[model samples]
Target: MSEPARDDASRGYRDHPRSKPGPGSITRRLRRHRPHYLTAAAVAFALVVAGVSAGVQSGAPVDSAAAAATPSGTAAASPLTAVPASPAPAASGAGRAASPKATPPPATAAAPKAGKVPAAVAPAAAHKPAKVPAAAARKPAAVPAAAAVAAPAISPELDGQIGAIIAANSAYALGVSLIDLSDGVVHGYGVQGNFVAASTAKILAASAYYHLVETGRASLAAPMGGTTAGDQIRQMVQQSNNNSWALILSAVGYWGIAAYAASIGITYDCTVNLLTPEEMARTLELLYAGRLLSARHTAQLLSYMQNTNFETLIPPAVPPGIEVFHKYGLLYGNLHDASILVKGSRAFVFVVYTRGLSESDMGPRTRIIQKLTRTVTGALF
Candidate 1:
């Protein structure tokens, strides 16, 4: 103590001017502040751990080895970085168990292969759409019905028979009009030619009278001079009385009958008093349809036609006792017959005009017309 104290005291005294102070005092002070340093270090370590934790949660890369080795470790430990060298069998066992559990999930994910079976069968199901158009395609089958409506009402067999009759009988310039009211068939042979109307003009006279009655210019029941208009009409129609017909003609005049025929769409040649068979047939058709006269006058006219003195043409061929409303004409070698044959409720008209027969008598022409009538009726009915 004496020597060291004496040296210390000497050192404490003024030394060399260039000598520096020793760090013994600073070392002692640092030892006293060791707790503060430890506290600061602990705070800095906590802040670094917090920053590493935030980076990991935010999916940022972490590169701190100390932070990785900490008790609260991070996912920054990769197989290539922090994996242990040995004692790795337990981790490998865990991975194997996880792999086995995941293997079944991959097998179950292959269930989409079963969906391909339905895709293969879908084409057959698609065939049902094609069947819808087949039902729609069946509508054209009804065109036959329209064709039936447009077909000619005249029977082809009846037409053939009448045509044969006209072709065979070549001596006469013959005209025929046959209308089957039941089927609305019209069979015309030479009906377009101009032929003497004969007593058929009496029908025009009756129509003119009726037309006058319809217009209130005359009356069917009123007397013309001594007898009623009905009486004169009856006499003219039934007997084909030339006197009665002349009287009616004088009253109605030629122009009056012509106007009436024109009104009903009949083409009449006023020069020769000729009317075609087609026009005559059309006139009778209008009469039967109740277009030419009133029911009373129509009945009056048709009633007179029921009983005729001549039954040589259409009447003899038809059934017995059936109403054969007809008229016949004989003038200058021309023999003509126009009739309405009534059976049950049906009525048909036949008008045949014939001239230039070899017989020069009525018998041969009559038989010819009668044969034609029977042939036509047999073929048609």
Candidate 2:
């Protein structure tokens, strides 16, 4: 039989006279291929290192890569291998891997649809306020008090001053009544006491005659007691003429005067010539207010009352620029004056009555009335 030739070179060992087939020969063969084995082992180790590095760089778990490399199917169902792998980065150059600590791109929030508002986000827990105590939360805030209102300027002290004035003039029986038109307050002492009206009662007579004229019961031009009623009224008021006053009184009559006084809400005894200061004041107040007469008749009567023959009491004490419409009365022992004092839009009624003096000696009582007038004007205006 023929034996085929074997190539020692292909066997990775050359035939050598010094080499013999044995354990030493095996050792020689291994030594001859050591570099190739070492190169292959180094390549495998490098591949394993590269796989672990890729797992880390791609954000996959390092153990997941280890589990993937394991041969048991048990590793496939392992919790580590169940995790998803991160997408690999694009290869840069030939074999460059991504850095392990490389930051990923930030995730973007979805935009809201057109015409729709996005829901507001809740405040972060760190920014939330602390809870208030129950006592502090239940407490109420304080409120300010309201301001006080001022009182009206009414003088009660004037009444005492009037009493003192009457006390100072103790000899003569005196009565006074004053009305403050500004505040509608009346101030006086002895206002209700009866006093002799004297010629001041002429105002009542004149009023009665005018009342008849207004009611169509009498005519101003008609003759009464020897003169026209209009001429007598003018003479009675402006000149204090006794004859004219008597004529007008006769024309109106005592009953007519009493009826007129009752109609105007006052008590007057025309026969005795007695009336109170308060009644006199009320009569003048009504006259000034136009309640007693028409505006034309009122102006006409007030015109007659001014600058009369008697100017001794109220008008002389009144200050300038103030208009005084007044009448004075004198009898046996009675001295009296009733006046309306006016300045601008303000006016008041003042009536002063005094007795216990002879008609010829009225200076002392008249001066006392003047003093009272000055005191009242100073206190008010």
Cα lDDT tens digits, model 1, 117-152, are 111110112111213376656766553332323223
lDDT at 271 for candidate 2?
Answer: 79
Measured by TM-score, the strongest candidate is: 2
Task: List model 2 lDDT by residue over 1-381, tens digit each.
Answer: 135788778889866776657768888989999999999999999999998889689995445466556664224544324544332222222111222221211112111111222121111211123355899667763531111111222244555566677888778788787764433344456535678899888888888889999999999999766778898899999999999987888888878888899997778767788888777877776666556775556667877888799887888898876667889998899888998776544466788888875876688888898888887766655
Lowest summed-lDDT stretch of 10 residues in model 1? 94-103
For model 2 the TM-score comes to: 0.59
Return the lDDT, model 1, position 231.
Answer: 75
TM-score for each candidate, following the candidate numbering = 0.57, 0.59
Clashing pairs in 1: none
Give lDDT for model 1.
Answer: 0.61
In model 1, the number of clashes is 0
Question: Relative to the unseen true structure, what is the C-alpha lDDT of residue 57 in candidate 2, on a scale of 0 to 100?
Answer: 91
- Residue 35, candidate 2: Cα error in Å is 82
